[model samples]
Target: MALFAVLSGLSACGLPRSGPTKGEIRAGSVEEQGDTFIVPVTAQVARATAMVPPLGFTNGFLGAGVIGSDVIRPGDVLGLTIWENVDNGLLAGPGMNSTALQEMQVDGDGFIFVPYAGRIQAAGNTPEALRRIITEKLDAQTPDPQVTVARIAGDGATVSVMGGVGGQGVYPIERPTRTLSAMLAKAGGVIIEPEIAQIVVTRGHHTGRVWLKDLYSNPQFDVALRPGDVILVEKDQRNFTAIGATGAQNRVHFETQELSAIEAIAQVGGLSTNAADPTGVFVLRDEDPATANTVLGRTDLIGPQRVAYVLDLTEPSGLFNARDFMIRDGDTVYVTEAPYTRWQKLLGALTGAAGSANSLSKAAGN
Candidate 1:
């Protein structure tokens, strides 16, 4: 009779007499218990970090433009035009003509020496500014000398594009009103499944990322390219691991441009029939052992919580919209089965018969 009472009490407590230790529950089981106890599904409460659709750019979004606002440099040719002035003893007819025309190339020092005008700074000055400087110098020698400067060779600005593009090269900035899209267009756009948001632009020592969607949707997020700017578009890494009881028992590779938790599960062919607990889905982000130990010691716990996230998919509604949650670059998702999941169907049939037999005995006693 005492042994029977002990058996009944053990069954009521829902714990087996002897089984796995607390350390052997696996990280997945702990998450399941937390969800079941803290946030009951019957309560209709939403998970703290449920996945949602990404919000694209907003506001007065403008396109990125080319860089053309810098001073002229060496290796640039200048076309100089001196007007034919005859009234002030300047004639343009023959070798002895007073109107002498010449094209001057700036030396390494950015100085251009004219016939009558001594040394004049030509580098780091706009064409218009250079023309004004020459006019002032020639005015001292030849009265009312007219001068015009024209750029015949190189512009001092360029931008680079690489990765996931048809052609990766440095593009010369031809216009001042160039935008990010315009630059990509110049590079023939990105390849299929390109990580648009991962585009990196480096200028000098500063680096920044420009989201392609943001550049198109948000008017205020336009990233302007400058001279010596380098734009790198690299292919995003797509790989994940799946453990626990599932239909397949191996890691899978998803070639999706952007993968989510629900989509990742589908790639592995869904959960196993008899071994899967729909609500026991978790993501384990393996961290450095040193870091894990530090975090565990702070909380005075035996082991650290390396489990990044625990997602409950038991509810039909939750499973239906699981695709909205985004997964990280390299994450391990585990699917565990509930303890009752494998026994509930069998226990139901025996429980009914046992209850009927007990009721009949009580009625007979009455």
Candidate 2:
């Protein structure tokens, strides 16, 4: 009876569990585990995941305009010329005589003075419009007067560029709508060692931004700049940490564009084959309580928005979930030991010791 009891105790079946069972893991935990855990990604969960907190202006909402003809502005010098046919000319005889070309600067008030056309608002009006105005004024004195208004020098239509560029200064807006790439190139192009990804364009109260390379590759994203727009090129700083069973435990830098959970894991060299718990992949993120409360139902458990998101790699769909899930900055990706890992190890050790004891008892009886 004693030998039979010993043998029964050493059996591998019905191992003691010190952690959550498979059923508990599948059903999902709402028992105050301190995470905004959502199972099966229901409608509410989908809504929250889809939500992107407004960052002042929407993505790609900068001053992206199509390029067009340039407009005259204040401080611009204009070459005004007037010609007369001399038929009904009150200023000249029957012979053809053209007035000397006059170069005048647009005043502070955006007005330019002409021989016949009194100070006309040239800053807000296009060159062609100002030419017509000059022709109309000259018509009173000179019959069939021909007037031409050309921009000699641009004075005020400019954009200020700073930060990580070869040339940083007030470069004139060359076109009616100057593209971001054109503006950057006019400012002597970006520095060799500069951050080519994060570029910012601020126009009055509204601002728009896009990757420098993306602007070049996709002309649509390379938005046009307004007169007073400021372009700031800066480096990226957001990074995430991978701990517990991952090959590398150090923090890894994120890409300028959106980064997903699966990509982040790959950056840290992925989970350990022998130490990782495929079912316990947890993404601990610092979420805003007010925002999390609105998105996720339970905010009473952990007030600060520090929520753990579970990813079960054991399931085939878990990898797909991770691939679609975006990872925010300052997040922690942790993989726990398997639930049955400890129990199996303990059982092997106990069985080995039992076999040793039984062998010793038989030797003593011999």
Best by TM-score: 2
lDDT of model 1, residue 258? 58
| Candidate 2: stretches off by over 4 Å | 1-30, 33-155, 164-166, 188-196, 212-223, 235-237, 287-305, 337-366
lDDT of 1: 0.58
Q: On residues 29-147, what C-alpha lDDT tens digit does candidate 1 reach at each position?
A: 43566411122222122222242234332222223443454455664556677753544444344543244344456677887776667788887888789888988877766667777
Candidate models: Cα lDDT each: 0.58, 0.66
Give the CA lDDT, 0 to 100, for residue 8 in model 2: 54
Residue ranges of candidate 1 with Cα displaced over 4 Å: 1-23, 26-47, 50-70, 74-108, 111-122, 125-156, 194-197, 244-259, 272-279, 286-305, 308-312, 320-324, 337-366
The lDDT leader among the candidates is: 2
> In candidate 1, residue 284 scores what lDDT?
59
Error of 2 at 237 (Å): 4.3
Model 2 poorest ten-residue lDDT run: 51-60
lDDT (10s digit) by residue, model 2, range 1-366: 875465456533454433344345445544545334433432344346544332223444543555443677777777776678765454444564665555587889898777556767888777788888888887877678887777653456667889878888766675533777877887777773433256788878867665666666665667656667788876555788887777788888876456777888888888777767877777766666664676566556445655567777657677777777777778887766664565565657577788999999999999
Instruction: List TM-score per model, in order.
Output: 0.52, 0.53
